[model samples]
Target: MKNKILIWGGSLLAFLLVVIVVLFIFRSRVLQYTIERVITKVENKYPADLNIGNAEFVDWNSVVLNDISFVPHGLDTLFTTDSVYATVSFRSIFKGRIVFKRLEVSDGYLTARKNGDVNNFDFLFKKSETAQPVDTTKGRNYGTLLNRVIETAFDNVPDQVDFKNLNASYKSPNRMIDVRMPFLRIDDGYVESQVSILADSIQNNLRVRGTIDPGDYNINASLYAFDEKGIRLPYVKKKFEGEVAFDTLHLSLTNKRYRNEKLTVRGRAMVNNLILNHAKLNDEDILVKESAIDYVVTLGQNLFEVDSATEVRVNSAKANIYAAYQNKPSKIYDLGVKTEWMPANDFFGSLPAGLFENLDGIKASGELKYKMKFHVNMDSLDYLVFNSDLDASKDFKIQQWGNTNLQKINGSFVHTVYEYGKPVRTFTVGPSNAFYAPINQISRHLRNAILTAEDAGYYSHKGFHEEAFRQAIIKNLEEGEFARGGSTISMQLVKNVFLSRKKTVARKVEEAIIVWMIENLDLVSKNRMFEVYLNIIEWGPDVYGAKDASRFYFGKEPSELNLNEAIFLTSIIPSPKRYRSSFDSYGNLRSHKGYYYRLIGGIMRRRGLITQEEFENLYPNVKLYGRARDLIVTAPDAAEEDTTEFELETIDLLDF
Candidate 1:
């Protein structure tokens, strides 16, 4: 009885051993057949040709595949190659969970071509108007179908997987060249990276560390993407570090009912020692140290939105620039911007030529603030508008004689107020000399007269005054002539600061907007506003600002003009060209218009700005001296026109 039982047990053990040997012996064929079956299913759905070589199965626990290649069925080009080896561990074989291990790829290549709007991978998957229903039926028959579907889905996925070592190259023709790193792993719907890339002729080296959730279609990479362009997108390269770091990049794709929605890019960049040549008023090179930039952008449904900020710190200077944008077909909205310049003089001197040439060597150290809001509409040329404000400091000075010299200049004005579609007004208050007379006494007198007539309240208003503008407008309309402008001193200052001398409603509107902006800004003080106005305001032909005017006319300090001299200077404000010239020693008009004196006297009296006695004292016939011929009365010539014949012709025509 014992021998019989032993024999039965031995037989059973032998049978089990034989079964294991047979399974091992045919393992390679079994794996090959299984892989071929999966490939066939994938081909049916996506039309792809797959090549498999030297597949082996191990103890019914795992399978190894070597030398695999895949190509689109209709396309003759190979898309990928897998060499060395791979093992599919059968830990969850019944459930079709493929855990790959020890994969190696060699001399693999991927090529993609895109032209116009056609992408090479557009046909990678089976075309379907709607997603197919999932098969939930059980039993071997239904199980086969489900397994085939899952295998087909995995085969159609776009991936380059390799372990151990991999050498891969990609050519896109229309896209950029790419060379990828070795060692790839995929498990549990997760693709973890141990990868690097050499792109653009291998001139750029990119290091990438990230994770991709294939099931969720999301990717995040911490990248160091750079080239030798000396120009970088989003961030600039700086010294100490030759490359900029685009840190913590993230991207995600989500499929909705109608479209595949994409959310792209969340990251920041760090660049050290960014150098900008000739960026300041004096054409000096600037170095931004440890500059950092942060940004986020999203694109979907043909719309793109971006928000970014930059912080730069240089030698004794620091600046912060913030910007945001929403791109749309009808309009571009400039959400907002705020730029703060600390120790502004350091950068001010580096501005380009023709921008602030006369301001060179000015030791102006103060905060400069700028704020603007506006929109541009592509549908209509007239649909444009913006409002801006600029403010600075009055304590700024000109560097001369190796020392910082303060002009005792304290003043302020509104820089801009209207743009696009808004009504605007502006005002200013500064030293009389800064605005009207920076040159010599004669030039100062001429400047004063011109400014007073064109924009009064130049020395009193705080950058804007609606009431004054209203009164001036009404007065001009009542006179049936556009002889007077209602702009304040700040408005005129703004015009001088940003534009040339062109008399037009558009120019006026722009000027008013700028002035209003300056008035509302906190970066610039009232006094600083005044200083800039004085430095830029035109005094006369070839004369600008109080300093130049003072040098040209009185040959004295801007502060030296007496009250009578000031009044005389102010009187010529309306027509400097008619009044600016040497006259006879005698009070009689010489080389100038007698009408100018009468006109000034009349205006002063009508405005209640002068006494009757003072008006009478300025009459043309106050005194007489010098040779009669040399002192012969010469009517003031028009500054803009010169022609004795034209005058005679006019007289003749009038007589006729």
Candidate 2:
């Protein structure tokens, strides 16, 4: 009986060993069929083609896929990977969940292309409109849909994900971007991505490691972006290239829809070795060795708030800046900038290159201290304010101006006009000085008419007409051109004698500096300044100055000019080069002259320069008897320019 039992047990053991061997031999084929069925079920919804070279289970907790490629149903291949390994939790699987402990992807390639608003990867899922307004009445439906999504996604998500050696390329019509990532890891709500990017002529390395809680719509991220080669910026359609390095940038975002329907952002950023160069500005370098900023932002539907404090070190000079912007009920921006005592050259050197090209030989001697406060509102400029204080210890000398120097310069004035002698020589070598006149030699009617028509606040204000300047700026902003200029007499004189005719912000700034110097230094008395202005002012094609203008228009002396004649002269000062358009083909004044005569005459009478009887008698009935003789008053120190006879001098309103 014992022998028979031993033989039966041996037979049973042999049968069990054969069953285990057969299962081991077919394990790969079982895994393959199982994955193929899973992919087929996924394709029912997402519609994607999945290719897999091999799949195998390592023990019961881990699975590995080799040579996997994913292609959208009717599209080209989107991604390819050498291997993907996933470790699943057995307990979760028993509970109808496919929870993963770790999932790693290696040696992957991804290609994405965008054409207009549609992109290549868009084929993976059903398409929908990009933007759609939310209806609160249907908010419960969204919750239902979200719950359904979570039930489905809970079985497919991995708790931890990792990728290595990924190459991605994205292309569009205007630009192409390429990215290479050596490592990317994500666990729970935490994510870390590091990439080296090269686009056009720019190359940079970026790392963003952060936690994103989608359930609460919150983000806390730290950024590290650096580039050895500078990036190009076109802020105002002007290209400026700058090298950028940010050692630390911590950002936190919070959503408060329950309280205010707003998103709040807080951040601290630090930068080093930032140098900028502009080609239009003659390739001058603006260097900022270091900068540190603390900023906060709050954004809503139609309103936003920004507050920032920055410390900047530029061109070896240090400055502290505080800026705030609010757009709730009304838009407002306020900025306060202060700088310690620094060399004047350092300040000037920091400006755009070629702005002071006309004064290359000039040297400024002194330390400069500056403080500025700026505020502006979008609705109206009634609240617009800009106050600045700049002081220098010594004078600035310029060799090319022959004897022009700036001493005890202060910050004041809205606009200035000047001819830089080289490109625009109308004030230097033209017939502008052919008939000079002193303030006493000129008639009071002409002076008062000019002051009334051009600058009513000429004597009251130091050198700026704040209200007029504000209006001029408003008009320009609305008209989108340099259409109006509320220049004071002193401002116009400085522009005529000292600056160029270019319509640029840089030129305007230089003109203001010169006007401030001229006013503060008392270099020229107000009366003499007006005299020089009248002499250099262009009257007609070849007519200039009060003497020649009186002779050219009425064949009279500056003192002998009548009320009507003086009114006519002052009316054309705004556009002297185009004043001939004011006359008809018969040499008689047009209907517009009647309007000007009434306006100028009324103002003149109000200022006591003309009596009521004279104002009433003044009419636009001036007769052009003959043309003025050809006369050129060239300054001995000025270079002569060859110009035509009928080429009127371009004398525009000194725009700021």
Candidate 3:
């Protein structure tokens, strides 16, 4: 019995040893085959690279694979990873399934770059021939191995991917990067974004939040657009920067059969502190220095259809804009835009012959609203209507206003026009008799008195006039109103040339600074400055400038005015409408003749421009051409002389 048992035990041991050796010999080949199957499955479903070193089954239930790695080409450079590592379980080896318990990756880097219309990773999958062929002769069913491997590999991945200490960077040419947020992720068609990116060149900050589906070609991102650039285009330069955040971004390609199939996307986003600098679009480059601007904006969009509602938002430190349906070539659709305060002077402040040349400085702020309807096929616009109101205030010392030195003026104009590619018609109306000269001609005796207080050396002095300003300030304090302005003639000219009608301490300071700059300019430029100021100064009513007002009111040129007419024109300079009121009523001027006499006396005492004799002759009988009418009455003749008939009768009797 002992001998028989030994033989049986020995035989069992031999059988077990054979089984163990066979398993050990096939382990490495089996492991290698399993990895290759996984690679083949990945290649079929998506584009990827999978490579493996020798793999070995360490024990019956565990596998160790060396140098197992994947490199997916065509992914954005922002999502590049150096290598991946994981330990997989072999318990399901007989069942033809892979179960990975742990996965880890290292040396991952991300970056984004914008170059015109092309973005990175757009060229991926261009070379499909580079893909490797799958080996189908492995373990498990030969025909089903590829599909199962693919299913297993994709199934084990988490819906949300986690990365450890990721870093990202981005760049664009010619634009200062205002804000940048590098770390980002997407899972289940939703993107997890934590980035703050800005660019000074574009003058805006984007707070991006949303989901992006790379496979379906849909993206949902939000942006905040602001315009603090403070300048106009062609020569303006400004910078800005800020942060942005987003929520619930979603996008998908809709296959609905209704109206052309489209890609729809939606999301919400917010932005803060966007910086802008040196923002300009030029038909021809205008050489100028640039400034920096900062501001913020927030907006949201829902159910955006790419085919129906293609929209683009451009925000930079200098400007903000939103445009939609811009790609349609045959029709003009819905479009909207909003722009912040920008001044012509601020934009062209440094240009030699541009908008800044002849002005003191500019104080400009307003809104422009318009609707444009057109036919894209004909490249023709139908009707563009807009409403804009602007007020320009000018003050001049040495500048002429109908033969009088213009002190200051507040002028406003409202314009509305309809255009079919070109202006069809326009209508404008404003304060009648607002012109200075007509009123001045009626109050001529007061001309010398007003001129005595004006600065004769205004053209030679810089912006500051210590004596004049001090006297004007004292006069203003005494009057309880802005009765006097202290600006120099050059300063006044500057203010009138470029600025708006806003009266403020800051505007005054800016005017002073710009006028000071004018003194250092050349003689020709100084004269040109004077010319621009004279031409733009508001005289009265709808009238502007000496030449225009002289022609309209007196039927004479500015140089043709006599002392009486010139002084009268000057008298109305302060308040043309008041003079017009006086002219309209005879009693008003008759009662005020004493005041006019006193004004003449003051003009004489001040070394008045006209002689004392000339002043006396003109003061009392200032002939206003159309005041009253002269009438002559005539009676019908009753009796007529009869000398011819009596002489004829006496002569006839003598002749017979």
Candidate 1 global CA lDDT score: 0.46
The candidate scoring highest on TM-score is: 2
> Candidate 1, residues 1-656: lDDT per residue as tens digits?
99999999999999978966765565555565667677887667665677776666544564555667666755545465555445565443433344454454555666665556544454653334466643333212322333334334544444435444444544455345455555555544445444445453334444455555545444444444444433332212222222333222333323211123434444445555454432211133334444444455444433455543444333344444434343343444444555664555655543322333233354544556556555544444244444555566665433341121122223333333333324243334334334443233333433454444555555565576655554554555457677666666666655655543545443554455345434543334554555565555444454455555455544455566433344444444445444334344323334344454555545655555656665555543322112321333344542222222111011111221
TM-score of each: 0.49, 0.61, 0.34
Displacement of residue 541 (Cα, Å) in model 1 is 11
- The C-alpha stretches of model 1 lying farther than 4 A from their native spots are 1-19, 44-47, 57-67, 73-78, 82-84, 92-102, 114-119, 122-176, 180-202, 215-220, 224-297, 307-329, 337-373, 380-656
For all candidates in order, the CA lDDT equals 0.46, 0.63, 0.40
Candidate 1 vs candidate 2, lDDT winner? 2
Q: Supply every candidate's count of residue pairs whose N, Cα or C atoms clash at under 3 angstroms.
A: 65, 6, 47
lDDT tens digits, residues 45-141, model 3? 5555655555555456555454544445654343555544444554544444555444444445556566776555333323245655533332222
Single out the weakest 10-residue window by summed lDDT for candidate 2: 642-651
**How far out, in Å, is residue 639 in model 1?**
15
Cα deviation of 292, candidate 1, in Å: 6.1
Model 3 poorest ten-residue lDDT run: 642-651
Q: Best by lDDT, which number?
A: 2
